[model samples]
Target: MLDSIKEVLITQEALQERVAELGKQISADYKGEEVVLVCVLKGAVMFFADLARSIEGDVTLDFISCSSYGNSTQSSGVVRIMKDLDKPVEGKHVIVVEDIVDTGNTLHYLLENLKSRNAKSVRLVALLNKPDRRTVEVHVDYQGFVVPDYFVVGYGLDYAEQYRNLPYIGILKEEVYQSK
Candidate 1:
């Protein structure tokens, strides 16, 4: 799997440091209030776990799975919810944790859905943001990194369910996907 990587975009140490900083900021922002982290499943699992551990305040977790890309690198422009939150978000402080935000389609849909549920507040925390690829307008309250428009995989991000276990985020080789 390492052979398929073109370059490491973010090192494991960098990810850890940034996650810690984000956690501190989040903890401060909420000021000890309990917050529910709504993790976007599959891709965000690793980030969600680290962030949850790093946070200092009372934190609860929930998982929601949405699919915009199946086995392809490009977004299909349609978002589908594979799983919904186990509990209601009404009158609760909800923070949506996502691995990456690319085209913004999925997050936009999710934010609207969550807002309609009457949550006290709904905010987004994305590990990586690719504004160059965004087609819809979505606000990210907390962001870890701004990545270039490259096909990135690793650190809980994947290409066809592979490379998620890699410790760092890496740009996948063009041939790896082209040949598929």
Candidate 2:
């Protein structure tokens, strides 16, 4: 609900423009190769759908779900794969799509997992990055926004499994989480 938001951080228009730009950049970078997009669900679902359409080349979609936060605002520092990719990424150029990267633990765990499976190349494309909260180093090939460290929701991000359908990204009211 809009009542739960304190402010809109990124407008829907801005998100669309940026995602288009990212698509062009990716299409250029991987010109002749068939790119396998590994969607890190379920937060990245909305972004992944938009991003996939913007891409200009042959793109195949796959999904992998790794969770560090269950119902909490912060991660437990333990990355567990709730779901795994159905197909092999062996010798394929893989790009992991994520909605946000906060502490980098989940991304790191995912990167290692994909690498071990013999992906020809593994890169990251995150819609949002909270660099202030990062405890480990992460290399994001494409990033939409470097947001201030806040509990954000919308455009695929969520708070307690809610707010993912909001058209724009927004900061959740502090009291909402504090009360919990």
**Candidate 1 lDDT over residue span 31-110, tens digit each:** 86889999998999989999999988889999999989999998998999999999998999999999999999999999
Residue range with the least summed lDDT across 10 consecutive positions in model 1: 25-34
Which lDDT tens digits does candidate 2 get at residues 1-180? 788899999999999999999999999999999999999999999999999999998899999998999989989999999999999999999999999999999999999999999999999999999999999999999999999999999998988899999989999999998898
Q: What TM-score would candidate 2 get against the native? A: 0.99
Clashing residue pairs, candidate 2?
A: none
Off by more than 4 A, model 1: none
The CA-based lDDT of model 2 is what?
A: 0.95
